[model samples]
Target: MGSGSFSISGSGSGSGSSLVLDGERGELVRAPAVRIGKKGGGKGGLLDEKAMIALRNHSEAERRRRERINSHLSVLRGMISGTDKLDKAALLAEVINHVKLLKTTATEHAKGYTIPSDTDEVTILCEPQPANTTNTSFLIRASICCDDSPELYPELKQSLQNLHARVVRAEISSLSGRVKIVFFIIPERGEGNGEMGRKILVDSVQHALRLALERVNSSMEFIPRDSLLNKRRRVSHFESSSSSS
Candidate 1:
């Protein structure tokens, strides 16, 4: 027999174990210890040439398995509160209990959840808008909320174009499956008293938003400069007649 080193067994706990990885005899030999011994010799009855090789292989495999299991247990101990004193088996049980409790709580909350109606979920309002320092124009604001759709912006632009409205400012936001758009637009220039003009501007915003809601996947409206000017003149004539009445 040649002379070399061997694994020494320590305290029964797994953590205290080092290299002696024998498992067939149901022994909890601890920490690995390097010892000066005959190269072909081993303690714990693993002496037969074939027997020693088999035991050594089996122990090494067992050690790797324990390492993996302990690694998972260590992660669980870190995540869960008060697991410092727990044994491996107890730690696993605690994790199972914790998961079950979380599932139960989530189930209870889902049972009580209420779905909102269309009216409850959305608000659309239109109003007159004050002029800004950079531009002097009759403006109106339209606020709309609807389900998120890729065609929202195109449809909104199409609707405004139908009424000859000029968009001065626009903001879009999305949250909780809904999209809200706030637009400040200048209605087509028209003949009217100040209050009459304001009313018409507000009406134009409302009409544009109504059209946007009604027309989905519609082509964008494109009005030429000359046509837009003529449309404004028509609006002015209509407002002038209404004011004179």
Candidate 2:
């Protein structure tokens, strides 16, 4: 059957009108309008004009809040590696994983284990392995106190490689003119026996550290103590301002 002409009609409905769905006629018909407000002959109704305005303002505020949350979530989604998928669940999972990794990194650096205060010297500690322990790998911890430099870490890594040792794991931390590097290493197989391996590792690491220190000392410009303190103060001030903003 062809649809008949249906018109939606209402007047002074205020905020308390019930909508009737006429399924047979396929039309929405509103109930009789009930006037509510100062002129409605009642003291006050729950759905007064003032209440409707308040409700509208609340709805608009909530919509803006949701839009802000969605914008932040979209930025996070774009940061994930596989953003082409366009799946909310996948993006959330990636964000969660990335957060876990950051937490782990923070915990690992919570304490300065290798570097000590009042020590402006390069120190290396190689733990002696007990005969009973079956693990053939060696652990070497190195701490260097020097000014911040970009090439220091790579130079140290190259030194380890020159000794024919492979780094299994490394933890590196740097702060305020101090750097600490710890390495879990294993000698290249067939290079030398156990005793020879230890000797080679010690010699190579010490020589490399001395050479690195000499290079740093020669190239570094000596700054006055007062100047260093002023530089640190400026850096701290900048950090505080940035964090506050």
lDDT of 1 by residue, 24-134 (tens): 444444433333334655553233345446656666776777778889889999999999999988999999999999999977885632222243122334453455632
Those runs of model 2 whose alpha carbons end farther than 4 Å from true positions after fitting are 1-116, 128-137, 222-245
- Per-residue error for 31 in candidate 2, Å, reads 99
TM-score of 2: 0.39
The digit string of per-residue lDDT tens for model 2 on 1-245 reads 11212334455655345444443356665543335555635745644545545644554666667678879888997776676565767778889989999999977896555442445566667665566642444555555666545556567656666775555555554555555555555555554357777777766776777677667655555645454333221111111101111
Q: Model 1, stretches more than 4 Å misplaced?
A: 1-138, 188-193, 217-245
TM-score of 1: 0.35
Candidate 2: the clashing residue pairs are: none
Clashing pairs in 1: 16-31, 17-30, 17-31, 17-32, 18-31, 18-32, 19-32, 191-236
Best candidate, lDDT: 2
Clashes (backbone N, CA, C under 3 Å), per candidate, total: 8, 0
